[model samples]
Target: MSDLILHHYPMSPFAEKIRAVLGYKQLAYQSVLMPRVMPKPELQALTGGYRRAPVLQIGADVYCDTALICDVLEHRASTPTLYPPAVKGATRIIAQWADTSLFWAAMAYNLSPKGAAALFAGTPEAVAKAFVQDRAAMAVGMTRLRPGDATAAYRSYLRRLANMLSDQPYLLGDAPSLADFSAYHPLWFSRVINPVMADILDATPGLLPWMDSIAAFGHGRPAELSPLDAIAVAAANTPAPLADEPFVDEHGIPLGSRVTVTPEIFGHEATEGELLAATRMHYTLRRQDERAGTLHVHFPRIGYVLRKAEG
Candidate 1:
């Protein structure tokens, strides 16, 4: 198996979720730190424009979106299983909700006036402005929860989580499942990354202790690898064989056609490649980059829109 190379920065909450999963599984991986903002040329080279952070690179295959990344990781390490069989359906649904609704609400509150002030207290004004602008650009068409509304919703959500945890150690059952990781990351930003904004958590009892339990699974052992080196690694190797799943094409598109996959909501960058596989769960596109060689980029079917590339 090729080295598990994770491209991420320290402060990405979704990246934290993957890191924690790696830690829980005790998987050793190579780390490639990405820029906090855009113009991620090296990443774009591999992804063909899909700019999401914490992309999992295994040889020449790149996995985007944490939802699909979680699935890939689960395949790699199954024991401390993220999807327990009994509640698998519930777990996935809850994880989806947490990743979208809970995440945005928590972020809006965490980056409120007071919270943002504390977060960038010592940083230059321009740095803060750039981040805001970058995020605003990503959030162009989406409706964001206002800070006050987010606070209300976040508080309610925390209380509900407290209720869920009152009886069990994890969200679904005795063990931590995908739902816990999904829920933990947003709150992690509030508590771990920007502690000043964590006051929102104070009102909910038992929530902090649950977060502490999740945090104990520190990021697994990581060896740093430079971006150039990571790209060279991709260039040196061919994409591994894909899973043996029958193509489940819903679109009238066929394999070998050129297609573009774009996220339906935020970060609407489009990635164009030759359609390689359209399995029930994911889409695989084969694209070539000068620096990275031929690469296979994969995205989950749920959140992305696939269209045959315009001629």
Candidate 2:
């Protein structure tokens, strides 16, 4: 099997989710540290325009979005399985909620005046400005929870998580699953990203111990690989075989149509390209990045929109 190459930065919460999974599985993978901001020519090569942090690259196929990435990883390493058969559906639903609602609430509160200062501290003023602008664009249509609201929601969620932990070591059971990873990242940002602001965790004690348990599974042995080297590997190797799942029509756009896909909110702007493949879980677009040559830009079906271009 071709090496699993992860493109991510240190501070990305979603990236932490993947890293923790890797750690839990004790999987060996190639690490390609990418820029948190733009000018990521190599990433643009792999993803086209979906510049979300922590993309997984496998041979010539790149998987975008952590949800899809988790699925891909589960297939690769089944031990310490993320999805348990008994509660797969329930676990997934919980993960989805944690990723979005819980994530936003925690982040909004974390980025309040004090936390933002702590996060971008010592960084250049322009860096902070650019980050602010970039995030603002991502939040175009959605009304974000104000800091006060976020604090309340975050506290409530933390208590709820603590309650879940009160009975068992992990959220659902004795072992950590998808629910644990999904739930951990947001709190991770709160506690690890800015511990000064992490006083919020004091309200719910069980969450703190759970955080330590999850954190103990550090990202497993990561062999350093340059972006150029990684790209060459992809260009040289054949894409892994995908399951023969027929394309189910959901968007009303037929096969071979030119289309665009974009997040429904937060990074809401669209990326235009030729529609290549629309599977049950993802949409792939063939796009030409000036340096990356022709690449398939993929996006998860959830939290995004797909539309055909008007002639």
**Which candidate leads the pack in lDDT?**
1
Model 1 residue 37 distance off true place after TM-score fit, in angstroms: 0.4
Record all residue pairs in model 2 with backbone atoms less than 3 Å apart, i.e. clashing: 138-266, 138-267
Superposed model 2: Cα runs more than 4 Å off: 288-290
Instruction: Give all candidate RMSDs, comma-separated.
Output: 1.1, 1.8
Query: Cα lDDT for residue 236, model 1?
Result: 99
lDDT string, candidate 1, 1-311, tens digits: 23999999999999999999888888889999999888899989999988877899999999999999999999998989999999999999999999998998999999899889999999999998998998898889999998999999998899889899998989888999999999999999998899998888888768887888888988888999999999999999999988789989899999999999998898988999999999988999999999999999999999999999999
* Model 2 score (lDDT): 0.85
> What does candidate 1 score on TM?
0.98
Q: For each candidate, what TM-score against the reference?
A: 0.98, 0.94
lDDT of 2 by residue, 20-109 (tens): 999998898999999877667787677766777889987777788899899889989998899988889978999999999999999999
Clash number for candidate 2? 2
- For candidate 1, what is the total of clashing residue pairs? 0
